[model samples]
Target: MDTYQTMDVAVVGGGPAGLSAAVTLARSLRSVAVVDAGEPRNAPAEGAHNVLGQDGIAPRDLLAAGRREAQEYGALFHDDRAVTARRHDGGFELVLAGGTVVHARRLLLATGLVDELPDVPGVRELWGSSVLHCAYCHGWEVRGRRIGVLGTSPMSVHQAMMFRQLSEHVTLFVHTMPDPDDDAWERLAGLGVEVVDGLVRMLRTDRGVLRTVVLADGHEFPVDAVTVTPRFVARSDLFEQLGGTLTAYPMGAFVATGPMGRTDLPGVWAAGNTSDLAAMVAAAEGAGVAAATAVNADLVAEDADTAMRARAERYAVA
Candidate 1:
């Protein structure tokens, strides 16, 4: 490990959000460091969407580009996970998995969420490729094909509707979801969506391509693509012990934060999926920018306050 060092801000996570924040802070002449575990949430997807000027770009490419850009602006990066963090000396101290420790005046938590998939077999094997979570992210590529929306909860209703817009043939599999009321049925009927009520036994794939969905009752429905609603669990254990609180949402649990990623804990901020479970790549990057701006402003205010206090002390001595 390197000698003890202090930085202006320490960013945990290296996805679009964290990298964006690091670039912003570094370009602003602030000493920023990003510690990434290298396990991105979208690593399995072929490419990312809704990102301007780089639509259809692979997630790895985008992250590499972001790292290069941030590094050019003098941002430091650590390729290890942050195991623990604690408040120290009016700032924060983070210990990495490799026993490296970092001190920073401010902290930005960009750690994203973990997607807990359904317990059905082959779903995990096909995730991010044939089995998707976001319609907007993978809709166009899989559009105009037979699509299946696996029901995990009532939220699956929205997934079905979104996919229905892309594909003419759509099926909502009530794998474990309760039966919807007449209004919900009417909506599904209006959208020309067929409802299949049965527990999914497994996803059937051939040569890594999704082919069909197998049911427990020996029925099989052919599908070109499939979508599922995953449980989003935040990666916030490192900071949660440091007075940060995780809030519950219908989708999952996330760190509670105010404007510009300000959390209830002082000297600590959170952004990206750590705070917003539903934020896409582009939205997460925008959040990173916003958080960086706010952190810079906070630092400026603190610097001014310290300078004024020193001046007052010197005047009193004179």
Candidate 2:
């Protein structure tokens, strides 16, 4: 099996967070390795929004640029998935699916998350295009269009209000979400949002283009775009292997971390969507940089301690 030399840091998932962390660590003169399976959560999206100076850039293109930047900084890239993890020699060892092993003194998880979209037909097929979530992510592109919000949870009402800000033709299909309270009804009315109460059978499409939302009762609502609230489940398989538990919330679950992305596990940290489910691209990049700085500081402290110990031993021998 191929094995890499012990590195200062090993980052899993080469998305925005992982690549950003690798760049920061390499710039600090640390030997960093990034392992990626090449499966990005946002790959299906047409463009990444709200990215400063690079707005609306294709997701794959953004990642390619990031990879080049990290490589230029002397960070190593492993185009493989980490399948297993364990403690080794007071550090961490990760076994990749490609039969490669990596050892690092510190581990940073930027594994992002998985969006479990609603089970309704066409929802998954149209995800990142006609079907959407996160108003800030794609709301602008869909402004002034026929927007429909699929109610899967209580948060659906809130989703409607957010889209209403961008367009006047907003409709909330209370498919499977809980019944809205009186206040919610009043709020919807005040905002001129239409509420449809029925089970959504499917999202009808033409040549992969979303056309309408079909209800179980045979009623169809024409919509240019449909929004949903997906359960954001963090990609924490390696974290779990390292004996870390995920923190659950109403929206989904994620890895719990303290300041600078420090997790409960020693010598291990989490950044980006792994720790913050709602983190956008810019926020994920920031988290990665923060975690890298913290990891570098930790290594510095350890090196200083080792140097002091060696000095004491030499003096005693003299």
Q: Which stretches of candidate 2 lie over 4 Å from their true place?
A: none
1-318 per-residue lDDT for model 1 (tens digits): 753578999999999899999999999999999999999999999999988999999999999999999999999999999998998888989999899999999999999999999999988999999999898899999899999999998889888999998988999999998777789989999999999998999999889888999999989999988899999988989767797668987779999888699988888888899999999999899989999999999999999999999999999999
Best TM-score goes to which candidate? 2
C-alpha lDDT of candidate 1 relative to the true structure:
0.92
Model 1 bad stretches (over 4 Å): none
What would the C-alpha RMSD of candidate 2 be, to one decimal place? Answer: 0.7
Error of 2 at 253 (Å): 0.3
lDDT of 2 by residue, 1-318 (tens): 998899999999999999999999999999999999998888889999999999999999999999999999999999999999999998999999989999999999999999999999999999999899989989999999999999999899999999999999999999999988999999999999999989999999999899999999999999999999999999999999999999999999999999799999999999999999999999999999999999999999999999999999999999
Question: Could you tell me how far off, in angstroms, the CA of residue 262 lies in candidate 1 after the best superposition?
Answer: 0.3
At residue 13, what lDDT does model 2 achieve? 90
Q: How far in Å is the alpha carbon of 205 misplaced in model 1?
A: 1.3
